[model samples]
Target: MVLIIFFTSLAGNALMICLIHWDHRLHMPMYFLLSQLSLLDMLLISTMIPKMAADYLTGKKSTSFIGCGLQIFFFLTLGGGECFLLAAMSYDCYVAVCHPLKYSVLMSWPLCLRMTLGSWLLGAADGLMQAVATLTFPFCGRREIYHFFCEAPTVLHLACDNTSLFEYLMYICCVLMLLFRFALILTSYGLILATVLCMPSTDAHQKAIATCSSHLAVVSLHYGTVIFMYVRPKTYKTTNYDKAVSAFYSILTPHAEHPHLQSEE
Candidate 1:
């Protein structure tokens, strides 16, 4: 199952990148954000899946201290980047649909490049903070992480010191990514819904609604799972059930979006 998920995510994201690269028509702001989304997913799934699969199969779950730290950093970076990318994509959709004439100027290549660069920088900052907070705690020789991956909550539990600061910081980061951005996405789509409804023809309204619905579905899949995963208290421990939930969003949703990407193309 792990191998299947890894390869499928790899292929699906890679396909989106290639299609956008090869097709001139798909080289717009939306597709550019999508290719970055694909890239992030590839980096994200690669960070944990291979080691996780090996651990599960070989029963060697021991991870080096430095390895765990890097894992947490990369995971948080990509995860946060994914959140910002989705928000940017939502705004792109809003601009394209709400103000079609100005979209070319507003979401031009330069603006798109800036947005993508900003997303990565913001994500890296978040990750660096969390990594520093996480590693600063005394582990007291604890090393076993309950979940398949080295998640924030799981790692924090190993710390022997007061985790209040790290936990609070994590909650803030979670709110920024999953909650705040989700609301922004919903707001963007709400405007899209209203705009599409005001279309002169029912066919146009339906077509616009269909497109917005697809993006909303992907957004919901991501934010819903991540919110559930991260919004818990600091003392939260990982269960196999939690790992399963993480696996669902991490492995399944991007592949599901493959069909939508193809249809849009």
Candidate 2:
């Protein structure tokens, strides 16, 4: 099941990227953002899935310190980028639906490129900060991480020193990354809904709803698991349940987002 999801997500995202690149019709701002999404999803899945599959197949569940750090860095980089990218996508939808006349002016190619670049930079910054901070802690005995990947929380849990202060700091960062972006998405869609309801044409309402629905679905899947994993109360720490939720977002969310690619196509 894991391998199947890995290959499917990889192929689907790669194909989406290719189609957008080669097909001129898909060269619009919306598809451009989508292609960036495909690229991010592809990179994100590749960061962890290959190593995870190899570990599962060979029964060797160990990674070097460097390998683990790289995993955490790339995981946070791509994951954080996706959060911002999803917010940008919602704003794109809002502009296209509510302010169609200014969409080209508002979401132009250069603006899209800037948005994409900003997402990558922000995500990389977060990843670098967290990776350095997380790794600086001295990991003591019984370093067997309970989760499948070197997720920051799982690894942080092994610190020999007091991490309560660091965990609080991390929680604040997570809130800013996850909740802030989610709130932007909701606000964008809220405006979209208001605009749609005011439209006299039923066709316009249907079209706007149809376009936004896929994005909402993808956002729900991605944010639900991540918020549960990172933002939920630390008191709710169950290793097994954490592993299950981690697998859900790591493997399943990308697959779920693939259908949106087809819908856009």
Candidate 3:
């Protein structure tokens, strides 16, 4: 599973990057955003999976304080970045389908670059905040982490004091990271679906539906696991159930970015 996850995500993201670079036709706002998503997913999974592989093979299930802190930081950073990038992709789809004529004007290369940069900056800020907040909590010398890798929720579970402040910050970040983008993706697709059905030509409608549908599919899969993982009130200390879900997003979500980009061809 480790070898599979590493090579597949690496190849998948690498291919998406290659496609955007070599194919001039893909040098547009949509594919550009995809390239960013690919890059972010690669980084996101890389933060968790390599450590997990080593732990599985070596039977070394423990991470040092520094290692755990850094892992949580990078995981949140990349994951948050992808959240914003996906939202950007959804909006690009919205404009391309619902405002085809203005897509060129509205989503120019400069604007797209700016949006991507903004997503990265925001993600970094959130990651830094959450990392500090989480790690500062008193752990009461508990060292064994039940999850496969360090995560905000898993890490916070080890805290010995009232985590109300950290939990509030976490909920706010989750709302911004998942729900905000979710609402945008849903609104874009709603308008997209209505517009596509009203189009006069079958071919034109089909093409628009295909594009919007791909983005919607990704949104559902990515956010479904994300909201399930984070947005709820903390429940169990650790469960195979949570680990399985986290593993899916960590392993497969990056893989999904590649085929979706390929389908555009």
Q: Residues 1-265, candidate 2, lDDT per residue (tens digit)? A: 8888888888888888898899987778888888888889889988988898899999999999998999999999999998888988988888888888777898898989899999999999999999999999998899899778899989988899999999999898898878988998999989988988988877777778877888888999999999999998899979998999988887788433322111111
lDDT of each: 0.79, 0.85, 0.79
lDDT of 3: 0.79
Query: Which structure among the candidates has the greatest TM-score?
Result: 2
Off by over 4 Å in 1: 234-238, 255-265
With a 3 Å backbone cut-off (N, CA, C), the pairs that clash in candidate 1 are none
Candidate 3 least-lDDT 10 residues: 256-265
TM-score of each: 0.90, 0.94, 0.91
Query: How many angstroms is residue 185 displaced in model 2 relative to the true structure, after the best TM-score fit?
Result: 0.7
Off by over 4 Å in 3: 235-238, 254-265
Q: What is the C-alpha RMSD of each candidate to the true structure, in Å?
A: 3.1, 3.0, 3.0
Model 3 lDDT per residue over 36-121, tens place: 88788778878877888888899978888888888888988888888888888888887887777777898898999999999999
lDDT of 1 by residue, 1-265 (tens): 6798789889888988999999998877777888898899999999988898888889988888788889889988988888898888888878777777777888899989998999999889888788877888888875776787887777887888898876887788677667788889999988988887777876666666655667778888888888878887645634776787777777676532412121221
Alpha-carbon lDDT of model 2 = 0.85
